[model samples]
Target: MAEGLFRFAAADLDDVEVSSAGIAAYGGDRVSPETLQILNERGVGLEGFRSRMVDEGIIQQATHIFCMTRSHLETLEALYPQACEKLYLVCEFAEIDGEVGRDVPDPIGGGRGAYEQVAACLDQAIAGIIGFLRGTGKGQAG
Candidate 1:
């Protein structure tokens, strides 16, 4: 969801490259039907989008790496200490409903409502992310 939203939101920017990978995902797995529905409702399509696991190549190429939870951050940091400087929680740039430092809950298997809530959270966070990137003059790549 974050990947699709970021790609749609940052579509106008040529310098930014948006991609999503999971810390525990099998390559070529399809996104959940709920995810497809939510994105489709927002006019964002995830056609040909298959899941991929995070690897050294992805880490080395990213200018900024946003994780959904602190656990994810810890995992990535432990595995790729050299990229620690670029690691960040996706919601770090914005607060959801006046709350700060909250993990963007994983909606997997939680049904449609859960997915909807996550999409809303990602919508706000993605906007803040764009603002942050532009403000820092680091929108060249991500």
Candidate 2:
């Protein structure tokens, strides 16, 4: 969801490469129906997205790595301590002041309402991410 939202938010910026993966994912897994439906309702197409696991190669290549929860950050930190400097909580990097904390609650295993809430949070964070990327020149003007 965050990947799709970031892609949608950065649609105008051609130079950025935005993607997301799960720490425990198996390659080629489809996104959850809840995620698909929510993004679809928002007019963000995640059609070719297949779940992939975060590997050393992916981590090494990423200029920035945003985790949805502190646990995710810790897992990555444990696996690749050398890359810890670039790892950050999504909310922290988004700099959403007064956000319920750095963690974006996992909406998995819930119903539509849970998905909706997660989507709203993603929308807010994605907007802030776009702004931060642009200000830093990491995302070039189209």
Candidate 3:
């Protein structure tokens, strides 16, 4: 979800700062071949891409933060209450019911179809987020 969402969300929010991180993402793992192929076909750049972990500074510095699931939102809150108000579950803004949807399901070890499914969901979520940010008059992505 991070991989695919970054592609669309980054472009949508090109006006706003955009970046993705894992709670414990591996550092510099070459993006999976299937992922690269999928995003590339969509014309999203895969160059200069590398994975990294979500750290305190990231949560601290972000004006608004988005996570893939409720667990992630909870984790972020547990670690930093000061940043909680700014955090959101990517699906939340879209009214997708993430707690019951569980997760977007990591498509990493899967095949092309799995990645595509993940990408689609992320694209919708990103659209919702972009709209939400715009509505709040928090017009700047911070």
Candidate 4:
């Protein structure tokens, strides 16, 4: 959901590359139907998208790595300490419901309402992410 939303929100920017990998994911698993429906409702379709496990190559290539939860960030930090400087919570740049630094609630298996809530959260966070990228001059080619 974050991947599709970020790609959609950042479509006008050519230098940014958006992708998603899970810390505990099995490669080749398809996105959930609920996820597809939510994104499709927003006019963002992630055709041919499949789950992947985070890898060293992905870590090395990423300029900024945003995690949905602190647990995910901690795991990434333990596995790739060298990339600590690039890691962040997805909501680091935004405040949700009058608070900052909140973990994006994972909506997996929680039904359509859960998915919709997550999509709305990602929508706000992704906008803040775009703003951060542009303001920091990180979204453009050097």
Candidate 5:
């Protein structure tokens, strides 16, 4: 979903409104402690963020919805059939290894090492997705 939002927010892009949602998020809560630590190590400060729920309002607003996993997509598809066409797994867009139908895993309950691995994967995938969007003329680097 990061790529979708970045593109939508891109200065030269048009016709898109991007947002993220977790069907059952730890609503109004902060990002995971380990996730923050990992982001910090990468020089990304996210202390201001407060996790929000992925509700119908969010779905209603987004034009192209991206999720981290298949379960997420399936759940949303089942619950919000009208919005299914907009739902997708962010990684699937990379067209890597026929992964066009899979999802990124959640490591929130895992150990510090798991957090590190997850961060690394996220960084790689997000970078690739953004690059794809840019190459497709969706957005330029800001």
Candidate 6:
């Protein structure tokens, strides 16, 4: 969801590489139907996405790593301490007031309404992400 949202938000920008991975994912698994449906409704394509577990190479290549939950960040930190400096929770970077960077709740196995709520949260966080990227001069704000 973050990858799609970031891509949609950064469509007009250049030289930005946005990707997503899981800390403990089953490789080759397709995205959840609920998520696919929600993204389709929002016009974010997910036609060929496959699940991938995070690896050392991915960690080394990423300039900024946004985790959906604090537990993910903790796991990555414990497994790849070298990449800790660049890791962050998406909500934390978004500076969600009074929220203490809560995990973007996973709506897996839930209905469309749950997916909708997750999408709304991702939309808000993605806006802040774009702003942060632009403020850092990594890409232009469009």
lDDT of candidates 1 onward, in order: 0.88, 0.79, 0.69, 0.87, 0.61, 0.79
lDDT of 2 by residue, 10-111 (tens): 888877888888898789988789999888988999988898888888888888788888999999999999988788777764544466336787887888
| Ranked candidates, highest TM-score first | 4, 1, 6, 2, 3, 5
1-142, model 3: which lDDT tens digit per residue? 3545554565655446676777767978667887788778887776677888888777766787877777887888898888888887776666444442345667867778888888777777777777776666443232
lDDT of 1 by residue, 46-114 (tens): 977999999999999989998999999999999999999999888888989898657999998899999
Query: Where in model 4 is the C-alpha error above 4 Å?
Result: 139-142
Off by over 4 Å in 6: 95-100, 139-142
lDDT of 4 by residue, 1-142 (tens): 8899999999988778788999999999888999998888889989799999999988988888999989999999999999898898988889998877789998988999999999889888888888888876663210
Candidate 5, after superposition: displacement of residue 141 in Å?
Answer: 16
lDDT of 6: 0.79
Winner of 3 and 6 under TM-score: 6
Candidate 5 per-residue lDDT, tens place, 1-142, comes to: 2323343334344633334556787767776787777666655656666667777777777766767777888898998899886666767546444555445667767789876765555555565665666565542221
User: Residue 75 in candidate 5 has what lDDT?
Assistant: 91
What is candidate 5's TM-score against the reference?
Answer: 0.74
Runs of candidate 2 with Cα error greater than 4 angstroms are 94-97, 139-142
Better of 1 and 3 by TM-score: 1
Rate residue 69 of model 3 by lDDT: 70
**Candidate 4, poorest ten consecutive residues by summed lDDT:** 133-142
Is 3 or 6 the stronger prediction by lDDT?
6
Order by lDDT, highest first: 1, 4, 6, 2, 3, 5
